[model samples]
Structures are given as structure tokens and as C-alpha cells.
Target: MPYENPAALRITSPGLCRDATFSSKHALHLLSWNIAGWSAKQKNLDLIAHLNKSDIIFVQEMWSTQNLTLDGFSITCLPATPSLPKSKGRPKGGLALLISTSTSARIKSLSSCNNIAMGVLLSYNTISFLLINVYIPPYSSRVLTDQAWEDLDRYITDLEAQSPRALLIIMGDFNARIGPNNDALFASNLWGGEVIDHYSSIYGRISKDSRINYGGICLTRLIGSRNLIMLNGLNQVDPCAEYTYISGQGSSVIDYALISQHLLKTILKFTVGNRQDSDHLPLTLSICLPERGRLTFAHNQMANPLHYTHKRTFWSPLVASNVALFLTSPSGLAIKEKITNATNPFSVLTDYDTLISKLKMSLMLPSPSHRAINRTGLPRWFDKDCLDVKRQLRQTYLHYRLQNANTLPPEYFIIKKKYKSMIVTKKRQAVHEGWKALIHASRTKNSKSFWELVSGSMRPSNLAPCHISSHT
Candidate 1:
């Protein structure tokens, strides 16, 4: 009646619905938000609204916040470390994990570092999970930059070592861009890219850096090798293409959710929530995990027909029926491209020439491959040469992300324009009709067909492998 505990509440709105899709498989909606220090009242109200929109929330930058509670809901907060000897006071922020009390996940072990790194080993029925909250220091520099990633990497490795057989969900303000680190330890520094490139570059160097080199043990390298989900934002539909830092000259995603391999197929949709509050926009994902146990989504012999059915049909846009039918599919890259581009402020005057330039530059490679560095006379301890390569790769990706973010035409502004010639919002009526069809399918048991429909919307190109965990 009175909103259970405002600090902890369970939302039962249709919008906040959850169900076990398969006998053992269930759907979990995980939401991450940087609330930007909302007032306790505002935080409570917002938590209600957010819970209405999501199943669980990972909140950050909630300093001086009021106690939160809600009916049928449970919350675990990693409070700011108390009384530090100046040198070790850590940061002032913390993270909170809110879950439905109706659900079975209970914290088995919980701990938080001063910088807001919290881990909770949770058990739901027979399934187990390790959920971690981390907020690495942003504003890149040489020493601190590498240290942050190393810390995160070590933390994850430690978790993995502890629970080798559990599902993992690591989320928060990573502060580090998926893009670059600025140090010269990386190849990008040798070639010239952003400081963030240093992360990859330094790790590369560490692999080969003869001194203090872990030799292929760097966190960035580990992320790539492990098959963890990186949630790419460069391409369309990676909702993160939009700028999260509203006021910065530079904008690329620093917030993310890295899930383990076991949950990859279960990822229903990864979306960026457009809420105004923190410098970082909220990231939302809907995952369909096994309710009872794992069930194969595809038959062993069905094979991937599309992998062999490769024809370059991406040039032609979707037909009216297809558009109507495919709009709701989670894999509709083109639909996202069309809708976001049409409604975005960046798409207006999107100079094709400029896009081409950015794309090319974004794809450029640094000299001396990671493999090459292993052979070169470069010091092995630091693998500084490999760092160079990492820097180059990150810079290339960052370049594209920045370009894409800038080209995004503001949605509100686009609707206001009355151009002399009709600006085709990609045949809006056709798309709307398609959306209707998608909605209908979603209501039935045929929603699985959505992927098949949307899969045809994008052309197949070899993008870099996403940072998913390599081993289960």
C-alpha cells in the first residue's frame, strides 16, 4: 500500500513483467544507471519508475542518498569506505544491486572496495551467479589508467577462479572507454591516437614488455581471449552509438555490462536507455536465462544456413511487408539505422563523403602486429610493442564511435524540420506497419522468428570479434 520500503521495492507493472520462458529458463532484465546524485525522495521515486521498467538495477554515483526500501524487493548497497587515512580513502561513490524478492537470488558473499567495486555471489535455485559492480576512475592518464584496468582484470579473474561454473554479470561505469588509452606504451601512441588507446597498447606492451610483463595476461587481452560480451557501440543498433556524456567535447561509452559466454544466446536485447540525470546514459538489457536448466536453442544439425547464404543484399532496403514484419526483431540493425538516423539530429546533413572518411580512418591498422611483436627484438616483459598495436586498434574504433556519435541527428530537431523535399524517414508508414506486425508476433509463441526476419536486414561483414569470454 505505502510502497513497501521506498528504498527497496518490487514493481509488478506489466511493463516490469518477468516470466520463465522455458521449464528452467527465465528472463532477467538488468538495468544500470548513473543517477548523478538524486535527492533521496527523487531516488525513491526514480527507483519505482526504473523497477517498473526493469527487473534489476545497478546504480552508481548515488552519494548522500537516502535509505531505499520497497515491498517485495531487496537491495544490497556497497557503501563508501569509511575513514581513510587520506591516502586510502578511495572514491566517494558506491553501487546498489536491487532484485525482486520474489526471485530466488540471495547474496551469499558481499564486499565492496572504496572505488565502488562490489561482488555478490548469488544463488537462484540450482543456478549460481557472481554479480560485480565496478566504477574505475575516469579521466585517463598513464600510471592510473593502466592500473585501473589491471585492477578490474584481476578482480574478474579472481571471481572466475572462485566460481568457475557460475554465470557472471559485471556492470557499471567502467570509466575506461572501450576505445583507447593515451600512453605511448601502445602502438597508437607511436602512430597517434587518443590516450585511451593506451589500455590496449600497454597491455600489448606488457605481453611483450620484457620487464614486469605478464605475457598475454593483460586484462584487455584477457577480455578478448575469454569471449566476454563487449557490447559494441560503433555499429548501428548498438544503442550506445549515441553520446552519453552530454556536455563533453568527446563522447564514447564508458558504461557497459560484460556477461559470460553461457548467457550469450540468452541476450534478448541490449539497449541504451535515454534518461537525463548523469553524464552517462543508462544501459538496459533483457536476457532470457534458463529457468530450470540449459536448453539448446538450435538443433545440432540445423546448422547456420545464413552463413552459407551470403549474398550482398544489404544495398536494397527492406520491402514494405518485410519492414512491417521485421521492425520488432532484436537483430534489426537496419531498422535501428533507419529509425535512429531519421529521428536523430546527426543524420541531417550526414555528409556521405565525411562518413566514408571516418570509416576508412577508423579501420586503419597500426604498424607491427601483435604477433610480430612476439618475434621482434622488443622487450618481452612490458610487451610495449603490442601496446602500440592495441592503441592503434582502439584509436581506430574510437574514431568511428566519435564520428558516429556526432553524425547522429537529434530526434526532436528532425521532426521539427519541414524540408522542401520530403525527407523519407525510410518510408515511415511502411515501417509503422511493420512494427505492428512485430508487435503481433511478440504476443504469440512465434517471437523466435523475429531473429530470422531481422537477420536478413544487415549485410554480413567481418567485424572484429566482440570481447566475450573465450572459455566457459
Candidate 2:
């Protein structure tokens, strides 16, 4: 590996992305539900409002998300035309991810299939989350249903490959019952029987819809191939299976939250919650991340973690594939022309510098002249509220652990929401304060004073405690 952090290596290479314990961690609370337009009901509005506060929310079966707006969230919705015939209130289809704007979490490079799936790359300060929200309709024809799953798998696989180091989170209503603990047990009608009140992390779980269908088979295959660990039936698992969908017809744990197996340690709790005016319930996943890094937004899929050095000439990655692609790019072709037309060595050197600048811009990076700060140390903006929320969040986790509970209490979320809200406010306030200080210094016309300020900001935090390095 070129770097000490293994997660810096793309996930396509086995074991490379697995050991990223050094990467920053945060307590990420994700809620996945097939809302089915429950928010239209006045009584359910409060529940939906609370759900909207989650760090990351995946909403499926949207009847009217075309005009759907959630406060303090950035929405990425995959709209469906609702061609499927419906008789009742409204046709339901589509998927959405409401990522909280209250935090530094930023998402970009969204790709989606019409009402089927939506994929995005959500980045915190250091770690990236490749989030995919999917909804597979229960088509009358088994073939059609199977095909939907297939298309979704392809989309998910492609997205994962594109953002190899991102922690993958796939959730939403699958509408497929993947049997029980033993694939044979579903067929034989023995789900470890009554002996298995709540089996932990078992695949093909026994639910109201006990029968295994072909679509379910496809879903299980996708799960296995993707190296995902399903959180639906895991620690402290629900005794009743907490089926996500229910109706006169049946109830099943169709909605789920699946994370890459390597993220197992990060997962604190996965619990199910019910909301009024909707057939499908919500699945809440609490991940204990130790770090709350700054947020980043990307224009395209991120190539890799940025390497900070003084040299600006490393604009184009020297890898064979990158070199080949860059050489054929329009900018690369133009650079070649400049080289051929150069009248003298100095002019050639000037064009070479321009070439480097253009290449960095193409990669969505600042030119050599641009200075960017690396904030790996504790932030200066952290205030009392930030500390209090952090304390409460930790306390809540401690209480949950002491009780050996299967799910997080409501207080955890209450603290989580407050922490997110406070961070946004403090960061904005700090930026304004910083600029004011800078402006005052510059207006004084004291180069010494200005340089001193610059040097102070550039200096690394001497207070940073020593820790074991990945390198020997």
C-alpha cells in the first residue's frame, strides 16, 4: 500500500478496505422506511417530523415526494410516474434519501433509476458513505419482480465499485421474503421452532411471509455477493422479527438496513419502529463513530483520499489507466498542442505549468496556488453545547449497553438531533469570526501581523496525543 491507512485503498481489493479502524468514526443514526405517503395524514406528521431529524433517512414508496420537502435536509429523490394502476388515495412509488443539512454531511454525484433506486456518495470529513435507497415493487409477474431486483443489484454493484472505499449502506423495502434461518427450515417448516425466539443475524428470516420466492433468492444472492451484514435480525434482535410491513394480506421484515460486513463494529443498534397511516415500518440503525469530521461535497466520484504535499506537479495521477484517460481527454490534447507550438523553453515551461493547473481543475482539486487546510485535530469551533451533546450521546450509549438492550432509547435520538443542529450553528459562527479577524489584520497593513496569524493557523496541533501507527 502507498499509504499507512488501508481504507485509502479502494474496496475492490479484498482486505484493503476492511481494516480502516484509523478512519474517523461518528455516531451515525440512519432511518430507512417505506413511508407510503403516511406524512399526508395529520396524525402521522409528528412521527415523520421526528424521523426527518435522523442523520440519514431513506424513504421509499412515496406517493407525493414531487412536492415533498423536509426541513434541514438535502433531498435526493428518484421519482416514479406511478404507471402501476391503483384505486385508493394515490399511487405510491419512488425512493428518497433525506441527509441532514444540520451536520457537515454532504452528498453529491447522485444516480438513480426511475422510482427503483437512488445512489449517492455522502462524505463526512474523512470517511465516505455510499448510500443506496431501493424499492422493488411487488409486480404481479414473478419475472418482472425478479428483473427489478437484478437491475437494482447491478446499480448497487456499479456504485460500490465506483466508490470503493465508501462504507456502503443499502436500505428500503425489498418486497421479498428471504425465508428463515435455515433455507431448508422454511421449506421444512422449522425455524429452529419455538427454540429460536430471536435468532441473531440469521439470513432468510422467518416472518409472516414464510414462503421463499424467486425474488427473495435474488436478494439473498446480492447480499452474499456484496459482503453485507444484514442488521434487521441482529443484536439485540426483536423476538417477533419486527416485521416492517403489515396488512390484511400479511406482514414481513421486507424493509432492511444492510451495511458492509467490515462496519459491523461501528453498528451500535438496529431497531424497528412503527408509524401511523403506513403499512411499512421504519428501521433505525445507530452507528457509533468516534469522530465527527468536517463534511465535504464532491462533483464526481472521489478518486481517493487527497495527499497533501508542497509540489503542485502531481496533478495527473501517474497510474497507467489514469494516464491513458488523461492523455485522451480534451485538456490533455490541448496540452500537446501547446507543447508543439512553444517558441522557446520558457514558453514551454509556462505552458507546462498551465497544463498542471488545468489537470488539477479537471480532477476537481484546487490548483497549486490554492491553499487548503487539513483539520485532523480537534476543532476550534466546538462549544459547550457540542460537548454536552457529545456527553449525552455517549451516556445514552452507555445506558443502552448496561441494559443489554436490543434497541436505542428515544433519548439517544433526542441528543443526536441536538448535536447535529449545534455543530452547524457553531461552524458557521466560527467561519464568520475567522474572516472578521483576518480582515482586521489585513486592513491594519501590517505584513508581520498577517504572517503571524497565518503561521499560527498553519501550525499543527502540538496537543494531539500519540497513538499507534498502522506502519510498523
Candidate 3:
């Protein structure tokens, strides 16, 4: 059992830790949901059965007319073409990458024309992860313009100049709204929340100007070139006023996840999942590493056998005996018998004003806007215990996506060995069906030719009518 290197290999130790629990050698699990426009019938199959416990999924308004396939995932679309519409509304979809089926998650497509962004690389066992899924396009000031935030900062500076040393995890729905009115000189001030949601309506003064405008830019070049680590920031997601978007009221917190500061101290748990059919609410982060095995070297005696016998360490004690049975059981033995019968280690600051007047009911910790306004009074420190060894590496990504979807080879066998003569040229399929019927008659809504329903399962219906010989 030793021949690995297909590439998603990081097997813990690039910071973003995991393993708070579960670990068939830390699999992979990344599920970003914003499947709003795919319309919520049965809340979009219970959000794809909680994104079938994820391996990689980043969907956003994915309604490119729907050629569906979310169970056992593997779809990659980023539509909004026909010259990228949106002068009226209903036409801002793009960003779909749903990989799972046993790791090796790959979905390139970057040089953004309107921004749906992608970059995943899960690979199992030997380990690997490079995740980058964005869907930035909101907060308009004209067509939510400024060349749509410089085409989302040149598709996040060309996906951090193509995975600059991997281990990323960018996450999505960046409708852009960082905290404290977003710093960095008003993090692209999202056009002051689209001019406060367009003068608080009156038919939002007949909207349009690219839909009541706004702006957002300071991702500080992927948070200073992948230094990341912000995790569920904008008021720690859903702190409850639950409004991905509503009309008769207003809401904000534009989803996010950053993380990269070497996995921000192994980020044990960073929560936010209460997705009510998408305005955006599903941001789970749980990382824990430092736990492999095998190490025994005590014979250095000034090594000289051509120097290279062994020297690796640092990976034992991942919760030493469950932290010694939670500090010796019985509720840590009644808080270590009241801190050893109160004999100072700063004895709770001498009964801290009689233990805050007998503990002001469980020492208070609920305020993320009062648990976003009382979400079942959330507490116990947001009920943590989250882990994701790539979500126990989803049975090694459903046995490598059904052995590469049934013995691989057929995702259009190299696009029919390079567009099999522009698809058997009959005047280039009648000028590609007359420019796809004039981009489906300047949409507004009705898009669904997602590369002709997933390019006929990667094509090969007796191709060879090859044309294209205009070598003049």
C-alpha cells in the first residue's frame, strides 16, 4: 500500500487543522451552498442532502436551466453568458462545482469573464487541498459595476496566481460585507449597502442602475496573498436575523471564510449552518491535524552513516488521554475540587465579587447579536465538536467517483479530439445554431444549454465527419 501522489496531499500540517473527531486519516469535506435560483422545491432536495456530506461543493444561483445531478455529486457550470446580462434582474447565475465521489476534486476554469471562479484539488490518502470557490457579484452602484469590482479583482488575482502554494479554502457568496462597516477604508463600501437597499424602497425607486448599486473590493488581495484566517466573520453567520435577503425588511452579512494563515491555528471549529433555502447560510469549518504515528530513533550518537537515518517528531498527544479524562472526570472532578479548595492560582480573583454575584447565570457568552436574536438561545459556546478529515474522506471520495465515473474515458474524449471538426461542421452546426438563437433572445430568464447538457457526457457519437480545412 505505497504508491501515492495524484496530488491533493497535505495530510495535515499546513495549518487549517481538523480531527476533533472522525479520521480514517482525515478525509476531505467542503460544502458551500447558495443554490437559490435552482429554486427551492423541497428546499432543493434538502440542500442536496446536506450536500451529501460534501467533498467539494460551491453552488450559487445555479439555474442555468437545470440539467440536474447532485446526488453523488460532479457538476461544473458557471453560466450567465450571452454577453453576461443583468440590466433588469433575474440573470446573475454562475459558480457551480460539486465534486465528491471519493476525492480528486478538480474543476479548473478561472480567467473569469463575469466571475463564478473555481479551483479545487482534493486528492485523498496522500492528501491535498486547494479549494477556491467564489461567486462575487452584488452591491451595485450601476450594474453592480466598477467593471463588477474589476471582474472580482481579476478573478481573485487569477486564483491567487494559480494556487500559490496550495492549502487554501476561500469559500463563497462574497456579496461582500465585512465587519465594523468593513474596514480597509470601507472594504469597497459595497456602495453603502446598495445605498441602504435603495432608499428603503418605494419600488426601490424603480431600481436598475445595474440594480440599485453598491461596491466591495478589499479582499486585500486574498487577504494579503493567502494569509487568510477570518473564518465566519461578518457577525459569525446567522447570529439569527436570518435574512440572506428579504424585501419588507433588510439584512446583511454576505457569507465568507478566508482561512489560510496556515489554517489559522488548526481551526478546530468555525460554525454557521442554518440554511433556510439560501440567502446564504452554510459555513462550516473544522480543522484538526497533528496525529499520525510511527517514530523511534534514539541512536544518533553523533550520526555519520552519511547523515539521514531519521529525525521527524511532533505529532503525539492529540488530547492526551482525552485530556486525562477531561481533567480527571466527574465534571473535571468538580472543577478540580473548586480549584483545590480555593488556594490561589489567582483564586478566581477572590470570589470575583462573589463569583459575579453567584455567576450572572452561567457567566454570559451569547451575544453574536444576542445569538442573532435568540436562536434557541444558542450557547455551550455554539455547540462545537466539528471535525472533517475531509469528512472522513467520503469513502475515499465514493471510491474515486465510481472509479472515475465507470472506468473513466468519456468526458467527451478530449472534446471529440478537439471539437471533432467543429462538431461535424455543417457550416459549423449552422453557425452554432445561429449563435445559440441570438444568445437565447437576450435572456431575462430561460437559460439551459449548459454546454448542451454536460456536453453529451463528454461526446463520441460516431464522430469523424471532420471538416475545418480552411487552411488558406
lDDT of 2 by residue, 56-101 (tens): 8888877653534454456666654545554333456867777665
Q: In angstroms, give how far residue 192 of model 3 lies from its true place.
A: 7.8
- lDDT per residue (tens digit) for residues 1-472 in model 1: 1211221122222122244443313667788877665332242343455655666778777663233333333566665432356424333565676654334344444545546477767665566778887766553455665676666667777877888888888888765442332132233222234343223311110011111122212334545555564443412225334444433243455566677756644566666665433456678877665555322211112122221111122322333445444444553444356545675343422333223223322232222222112333322322443344434433543454556444433432232232101223324544565566667767775756555444433322213235777794
lDDT to native, each model: 0.48, 0.60, 0.43
The TM-score that candidate 1 achieves is: 0.48
Question: Candidate 3's residue-wise lDDT over 1-472, tens digit each?
Answer: 0111112133333333444433435434566766666632222333445676766667766654433344334455565432345433445566666664333223333344455565544432223356666776664355554555566556655665765655667777767543332222232444455323211111000000111113323443345443454444322221221223321123455656675655554554555554433445566655543333101111122112221122222323643544565556665566556755886543443233233223222322222221111132322122222112212233332343345332213432332232323323533454466467546744534445544423332333213235677894
Q: How much lDDT does candidate 2 score?
A: 0.60
lDDT of candidate 3 at residue 392, scale 0 to 100: 29
Better of 2 and 3 by lDDT: 2
lDDT, candidate 2, residue 359? 50
Model 3 gets an lDDT of 0.43
Clash counts for the predictions, in order: 69, 6, 42
Worst 10 residues of 1 by lDDT: 203-212
Model 2 residue 373 distance off true place after TM-score fit, in angstroms: 50
